[model samples]
Target: MPSSDDVYSQLKDCVSEITKIPRGEITLNDSLSGDYGYKDGPSRRSFAISLERCFKKHGMTIPKKLDRDKMEEAKKLKNVRDIVFTAFGV
Candidate 1:
């Protein structure tokens, strides 16, 4: 199994790609829209979906409840770190 840190790193990398947010610019205190230019809530939703696709590509699956909650709570994540920690449990 991958370590939590590894998972977090992967998530961060993939999220960066999906959100068009640069690595250094991503923080735990930034909202996807305000920080990453996500114009609407659906963009954040798509981010989560992209994350799930990434996870599935790696032969993993985020728990359904957690996935749903992650999708719902995307805007509340303080930064990239917060999202990674919450979703991947790092």
Candidate 2:
């Protein structure tokens, strides 16, 4: 299994690709939109969907609850680290 840090790195890349925000500019203190430049709901949804796809690609089976959990965190994650924790439990 990939370590949380690995997962975090992949997530950073994924978020960068989805949001068109530079990975170096995205801080752990940054919210997905307020800090990372997500323009709207569809953009945010794209990020979440990419995350689910990445997790699946890495051989992680997302529990159905985690889908709802991700959506909840989608609104509430205070920072990038929260997204990492929400996804990978680190």
Candidate 3:
């Protein structure tokens, strides 16, 4: 199995590609809204979808509630490390 670090790195790469954010620009402290500017509902929803897709690619799944919440909770999901920790339980 891939280490947590490796999984996080892959997630970061996927997020960078999906969001069009540079890999170096993303960090464990960055937020989806405050840092990445995913302010609108549509943008947030798209972000949530992208995150789900990334998790699926890694053989993980987040709660369906994430979708129902309009991805509002995802705003708290700062950085790649948080994403990996949440999805993989690492």
Candidate 4:
């Protein structure tokens, strides 16, 4: 498992890279879709997939992509905390 610090740090970096919103501005409350525009399709999938590499780089293991085909299941992950909690279970 990735240390909590690694998860947050890497997640901040990823959000910054994906949303172009600078890491300093990123917050746990920011909605992955509403704030970052990761609504569906390639964007969300890419983010999920990228997390796999990010966590791996930190020597942690999480599913490569929690790509939920069902909209209802997918909708549950709305923010940084949601994504990290669901993906890392920590």
Write down the TM-score of every candidate.
Answer: 0.61, 0.58, 0.61, 0.59
Name the TM-score of candidate 4. 0.59
Candidate 4, residue 14: how far the Cα is off, in Å:
1.7
- Between candidates 3 and 4, the TM-score winner: 3
Candidate 2: 10-residue stretch with minimal lDDT: 61-70
Candidate models: Cα lDDT each: 0.61, 0.58, 0.65, 0.61
Evaluated at residue 66, the lDDT of candidate 3 is 39
lDDT of 2 by residue, 1-90 (tens): 557777677666666666677888755666655665554666666656666776667566433223433444464234434555555666
Backbone clashes counted, model 2: 0
Global local distance difference test of model 2: 0.58
Instruction: Give the least accurate 10-residue stretch of model 3, judged by summed lDDT.
Output: 61-70
TM-score of 2: 0.58
Q: How big is the RMSD of model 2?
A: 3.7
Sort by lDDT, best first: what order?
3, 1, 4, 2
Model with the higher lDDT, candidate 1 or 3: 3
lDDT of 3 by residue, 24-88 (tens): 98776677777778877778777767877776776655433234253655664454355445556
